[model samples]
Target: MRPLRIAVCVKPVPDPKESNRLQIDPATKTLVRKGIPLVINPLDRHALEAGIKLKEEAEGKVTVFSMAPPAAEQTLTETLAMGADEAVLLSDLRFAGGDTLATARVLAAGLKKMGEWDLIICGAESFDGGTAQVGPQLAVLLGIPWLTRVCQLKREDDNHLLVTVEDETEQRDLLAQLPLLITVDSAVNQPRRLSLLGILAARKRKVITFTADDLPVDLAGIGLNGSPTQTRDLFTHESTKKVELLTGSPQQVAIQLLDKLGLTEKGAGQ
Candidate 1:
């Protein structure tokens, strides 16, 4: 039987402290990651871990892909060290400042070139934008069955797979087949820690690099110029309401909190 082919999508994000300083220029209407300490997007790390674990369980190959500036190669290299069989970096000046749609387009093009894949995994949301749009958007571009917030997965056969997902109010158990896309929430398994052997293997892995020119792209709809959405403004806010300390026992505090929320004793704690 052919080994299962899995592709995990990841992104580089600025460090929390550094990224918090990001500002959008009204004139340019573009986001800039320059001078930011970039690391793997938090949720993407969990997605990568899912792929790695799936590979271990089913004896398959796992490849990691990133869509970001050329500088993103550093994170890609780190993912290799984390046990991915290979890494692909899709970087280009043209891809800079791409919105979710354009970003997904370019990413789909790049992944398509890697050959047939049985499964594609991605983080449920990005720390920078927190849009949670890329994974589902990419699945649409690929024209495949997709399920998000997947917390567990088990391979049943070459053409079938089972997954458990936590939706808003209930668990959504799924029986999906190959050529499907799955977006993972942080509820998934904790990502593996970096190890010495894994780090050594990463140093030897060859990471494939691609640019906008290497992939089939619609020049007019990609990059900063093609993005339709724009951020209006961002500013820090301070709450004007003062905090009132409720000094009392647990039961008393609970009653006070419930009253504050407009719930009466009958409606609150029973």
Candidate 2:
């Protein structure tokens, strides 16, 4: 049996639990990201969990990779604590404000530099962007077959896997070949929690940090300048809900509903 080499893509996002603290920058048109703690994108954790489990089954190596700012090293540290064999952080000032395509390009370059691997895994989408674009884009850049929204996966053999991809309306099972990319959803598995022992173990493992110059990346295909998408606007909608309990007979309730909706001659606030 051959060892399976798996690479998982991860993203650092503002702790969703603290989303109230998140604000948009009026001048830069970016997230006013500061003071807020960071955590791995929820779905990406599932991706990492999938790779870790596969490595355990095949006696393989699982590497974690991310394109983020220097501060995101903390996020990668968390992944190492969760059992990733090796972790790589691709950080460069020029890589900031990159769109999904640009981000994928840098990651693809990193993978190329790392040489051949048997499998690649990523989250179906990120909680912040929710674009679900990076995984498929990486597949296209690497010219490999890919599966998305995979909630179930089983090793059929060293070279093949049985995978199930699901959505609200569709679910399909298929056999996948090696050197394939997959984006997993939360339905795949519950990501294991970080343990004290794992944290202690992670201290011995140093994360690899690379700048844009370190990889064979085209300077023209990176950074905010390389991103084609432009932000039109950033705003949050304010939603207010008013609950009113109407206690009346069937006929009276119908009248009340109509009145509240301003459908009657003597409408609401009458």
Candidate 3:
């Protein structure tokens, strides 16, 4: 039987701890990425780890693809240090101000250029956007069956795969036929640290960079003009929880809180 060919889609995002502030262009209504420090999207790290584990088990090649501003090359390098065989970066000014739909269009085009693969993997969502729509939406464009929130995977056969995942309200164990797409849940696995050797190799690795013109993408469906969704307003919220004090012993305090919420009986909160 042939070995499995895996492709993992990754993204670069700003570090969450630093700042969630938007640098917007006043005239253009576009988010400015210039001079922004980029990090690998948190969820994507799990997806990459899942791909590496699968490669170790199945003896296959694992390729990673990312779309972002030109500075996002750092993200590709980081993934290589984590054990991806090769990396591809799609960076283009034409791809700026894109929403999820525009992102899927360019990514699907890049996948075509990267050669045929048996399985494609992605994070359930990007931490920066957290839209959680790109993977499944890309599958729709690629005409393939896609599964999300996959927490576990095992080989059922040469051409079959078993997956355990969580749905909106329940957990499901499913047997998926091969040549399908999957989005890994962040809680599925822990991503490994980069080995010294891998880091050294990453320093010398060549990440293939492509622009919008490099692929057969519909120019109309790739950037700001193609995105249907628009951000109308944005702001931050102040905490509104009121603090209360109870003059009582530990158990008495608990009882008082329960009484306040009318939860004197079991399952009252529910």
Candidate 4:
């Protein structure tokens, strides 16, 4: 059989450690990522790992794709260090402030340009957006079938796969054909750490970048203008705590607490 062709989609999100510092742009209603460090969306690492393992087993190459700003080139380089044979960055000012659908449109154009693939892998959701919409949307744009929240996957052959998916209620096993897309849950596998050799090898490879002009995308269907969902309001949540101490006998304190809580009447007999 010919080598398996796999494509993995990844995203660069703000570091979880510094999430508290993240802010929303009032003007654009988008994330204010400037000056913040970027990291691979945690679950996406698992997706990359799955693709790499499949490549190692099937004797194929894995390509990583991302739709992010030029700064995300570092994040893509990290994926190369993690075992992806090549990386592509879809960066353009016109691609900014996009919702999941708009983002999927850009990715679809990029994937079409990259040629055919046997499988595409992606994380179930992005850490920042927590919206599990891109994978399925991209599949729709590419005219392929897609599965999400996959916890286990095994190759039945070059053209078929057995997959298990889980949600809060139950797990279901399903068989999928090739030329497929799957959004894997974090439980699928543990992501491997970066090795010195892999890092060294990655430095020798260059990440290919594509702008809006490079792909066959309609200008009216990308970026902020293309997004159908609009944020009505954006703000940070504030929490406050209060404590009080009562001085009295056990019975008096209990009565005071009940009255303060407005439960005295309901618990009068009990």
Candidate 5:
């Protein structure tokens, strides 16, 4: 049997621990990411773990793909240390400020250029955007079947798979064929840590980079210009707290509270 081919999609998001330091740009209505250290989106780590586990069991290779700035090369390199055979980065100034749909378009084009694959895995959503749109959008663009919120997977055969997915109401098992895409939930698996040997091995390998010109993408369909949704307003919410002490007996204080809340009449009616 031919070895299975797997592709894992990942994103570099700002560390959640540093969320306090994150700022929103008034002009773009986007998070200001300058100087913040980037790490793999928490849920994306589960997706990568799924792909690596599949590759190990099915005797195949795993490649990690990302659409990010040049600085994200370090994030992709970390995937290499996690057991991906290779990594590809799609980075270009023209690809900046892209929304989920625009991102999927570029990813579909890049994946088409890379080669054929039996499976493609992604996180259910990005931590920063939390849109949960890219994976399904990529599936639509690629013209493939896809499943989201996947919690378990088993290889039934070279061409067939058994998948388990969970939603708010129920968990169900599904049978799917190859050339499929799936977005895994964080509950799917625990991500493995990097080892010294894996890190050293990753240093010897290079992350392949592709610019806007390298892929077959319509310029009009990428970046901020291609995004259909625009944020009209962005601001930080100001929260205020007020404390008052009512001086009286318990009964008087209770009545005062109801009056203050404008519920005295309603309480009396009841």
Candidate 6:
């Protein structure tokens, strides 16, 4: 059997449950991360599981990659327990304030440094960004064909397999070849929980960390400075309900309702 080597890209996102504490930095237009707990992106778990499953069946290796803050190292630990043989974290202060494109560039560079792989897997999108652009952008940067929103993958042989991708209209079944990149949907599988035994085993597994200097990438295009999109404004919408009561004759209520809605004839008649 050929030695199958798979690489899965994962991201760390702030725990969505703690969104109440979330804040944005006006100067940077980036989320304020301090004091907020972090967790692995929900959808990325499915991607990791896909790689792990393939590794188990193929008796190969599953390695994970990420471009995140150093704090995300803890988040990657949980992923190691989930079954990756090892992990590579591309963390650096210079990599901060990146948009999706910059992030994809960083990830692609890191993965390139890790050498060759038979398969590259990623989550369809991240919960925090929700742009779902990284997977495809990374594919383009690496010059690989990618299938997004993949729901199921059944390996037919060592290199070929039957894949089910969920499109907006319908599901597509295709025979995919090796050396392919795929972004898996969250519904692909029920992610397995991290057990005590797995955690113990992860202690022995390796976790390699890298910085932009460690990879071959243009310094001008790997961070916020390298990002093209700029946020002009960032603010939260207040959804608190404002209630008003009108109790009077039908005519009076009608007038009041119209006035509240600015539909009164006063301005129109003028």
Residue 135, model 4: Cα distance from true site in angstroms: 0.9
Off by over 4 Å in 6: 239-270
How well is each residue in 66-95 modelled by candidate 2, as lDDT tens digits?
Answer: 999898999999999999988999999999
Sliding window of 10 residues with minimal summed lDDT for model 5: 261-270
Candidate ranking (lDDT, best to worst): 4, 2, 5, 6, 3, 1
Pairs that clash in candidate 2: none
lDDT of 1 by residue, 43-131 (tens): 88998998888788878999998888787888998899999999999988888778899899988988898877889999998887899
Each candidate's lDDT (Cα)? 0.85, 0.91, 0.86, 0.92, 0.91, 0.88
lDDT of 3 by residue, 13-60 (tens): 877665656566666655566666778888889999988888888789
The regions of model 5 sitting more than 4 angstroms off are 239-270
Better of 1 and 4 by TM-score: 4
Better of 4 and 6 by TM-score: 4
Q: How many collisions per candidate? A: 0, 0, 0, 0, 0, 0
Supply candidate 2's per-residue lDDT for 51.
92
- Model 4 residue 115 distance off true place after TM-score fit, in angstroms: 0.4
In model 3, where do residues sit more than 4 Å from their true spots? 20-36, 244-270
Q: Flag regions of model 4 displaced more than 4 Å.
A: 26-28, 239-270
TM-score of each: 0.84, 0.91, 0.85, 0.88, 0.89, 0.86
Better of 5 and 6 by TM-score: 5
Each prediction's Cα RMSD?
A: 4.5, 3.4, 4.5, 2.6, 2.6, 4.2
Worst 10 residues of 1 by lDDT: 229-238
Tell me the TM-score of model 6: 0.86
- Model 4 agreement with the true structure over 149-197: per-residue lDDT tens digits: 9999888787988999998899999999989999999889999999999
